[model samples]
Target: MNNMIELKNIIKIYNSKKKIKVLNRLSFSFKAGKIYSLVGPSGSGKSTLLNLLSLIDIPTSGNLRISNRNIDFNSKSDNDKIRAKKIGIIYQDNNLLPDFTAMENVYLARLSIEENKKKAMEDAKKLINNLGLSNRSNHLSSELSGGEMQRVSIARALINSPDIILADEPTGSLDTTNAKEVFKILLRLKNKNRLIIFATHNRYFANMADCKIELNSGKIKRATNARIK
Candidate 1:
């Protein structure tokens, strides 16, 4: 598989009361066709790293390349286009608009790529039905249960058929049963053209990944099944 994401000497610092280094010379290359579980303690810069991968944030210093194109962080419009076409992000909160129906929430993402409303709705319904949410398609997000809401979130994430999936604590809010079910759906999403990375504290979920990446004191520490350089 080709390298989907590449980082060189990546460093991130946050300044408020003082200068805090979150990622110190973190360098890693993530390839396509793999599921990587990001495991780290709280405040270990897991979200910071995800933000970089998703093109939502830039590093203080270093290089980032995605999908074979070198990223120019200063080009906000170009980066936004890359994110819309290549990256799919899943948040812990499911981030759905409360007033929109589940179908609307999913189809809205499709508009970022195309202007055809009818085609977007058809594609959205197919994705939702595939996710076992057809019955809840018309239900308002506020009326859906936590698990159902998360499923809708997944459908939205897949709407663009993104090449990279960045999930931040994807199942953190659900009970064990729901978390497991949701994760199963997430794992089933992997394909040769996609690179899936999810951050989680759950050891069980972490172990299921093809590779385990532990962030310790702002560095990428590889554990079991990791063959990346």
Candidate 2:
């Protein structure tokens, strides 16, 4: 497998009232074609790591390479372009626009990468139907159930056909049944050409990943042959 993303001695710090260190000289390489689950207690820097991976946050120091190319964090436009072309992010809150219908929310994501509305809508409709949300595509975010909203969010994330999918507590707010359903949809998205990484507190879902990694005190401990049967 190719190394999709590589971090070299990355460090992240927050200096507010007190100097707080989140990730302390952490380094890891993520490869394509695998689903990695980041499991940790609250405040353990799982979300922080994902943010850095998504280029949503820059490391305080050290290097980040994606697709074997070093990232130039100083160039905001380049980062935005890379993010739009290579990264797809899903948030715990389902970040859908309240005023837009599910179809609109999903298709609007394509505007960042594609200019044609007709093509974008066609792609969005296929994704919505594939995710079994064809009937709910016209419903506003406020009108859909939590699981339905999450499916819409997933469709939005996939609209650009990103190479890497970063999901942070994707099912954290759902009930057990809905969480399982959402996870099933997520697992189905894994392929040999893309990378899927998610942060989760649910052990069952975490164990379903191809690799299980535990983060504690800003450090990572990966399990050997952790893929569940």
Candidate 3:
């Protein structure tokens, strides 16, 4: 299998008054055409690992390669461009702009890669329709339900057609019904050339992944019978 993302001896540390280590020389590789579930307790560095994978946060000491290209953490501008072009991020909070409508929220992300408003809106509309959120496209973020807002966020993430998607608790705040619905949508996005990694505390959702990874005390372990193919 081709490795889509590879981390070599990754270490993340936060220094305030004292040194706090998050990831301790962690190494892993993710392959395309698979969904990975990162399972761990609240403080087990799940979010931190996702942040690093998304290039939003840098590892204190490590080498990260995406699609065989080495990442230069010191180049903020370059990393930002890579993120906009190749990486999509979904947050648990749905991180939509309160003042923008659902349509605006989804299309605005596309503007980063394409400056044409008409083209961006056209693509966003198609994604929104496919996600079954067309009726709520004009509604403001605050007016939409939690599930609706999350659907919009998913549309936004997909608008860029990224090769890798990093979702941090995509359905953490939703009810059981809504959470299952969102998970189905996520599963439908799986493709032979795309890699989807999500961090979740829900066991049902985790088991649905192609591989289940457990993070503990800055280390990672693959659970038994993980369906990696």
- List TM-scores for all candidates, in order: 0.97, 0.98, 0.97
- Candidate 3, RMSD to the unseen true structure: 1.5
Q: What C-alpha RMSD separates each model from the true structure?
A: 2.2, 1.0, 1.5
Q: Give all candidates' CA lDDT scores.
A: 0.93, 0.91, 0.92
Clashes of 3: 0
Candidate 3 ranges beyond 4 A from true positions: 223-229
lDDT tens readout by residue for model 3, 136-219: 999998899999999999999999999999999999999999999999999888999999999999988888899899998898
Superposition TM-score, candidate 2 onto the true structure:
0.98
Candidate 2's residue-wise lDDT over 1-229, tens digit each? 4999988999999888997788888888888998999998998899999998898889899899999999988887999999998999999999999999999999999998889999999999999999999999999988999999999999999999999999999999999899999999999999988999999998988889998889887778665446778
The lowest-lDDT stretch of 10 consecutive residues in candidate 1 is 220-229
lDDT of 1 at 215: 96
Which candidate has the top score in TM-score? 2
Ranking of all candidate structures by their lDDT, best first = 1, 3, 2
Per-residue lDDT, model 3, residue 58, is: 94
Cα lDDT for residue 57, candidate 2? 88
lDDT over C-alpha atoms for residue 135 of model 1? 96
TM-score preference between candidates 2 and 3, better one? 2
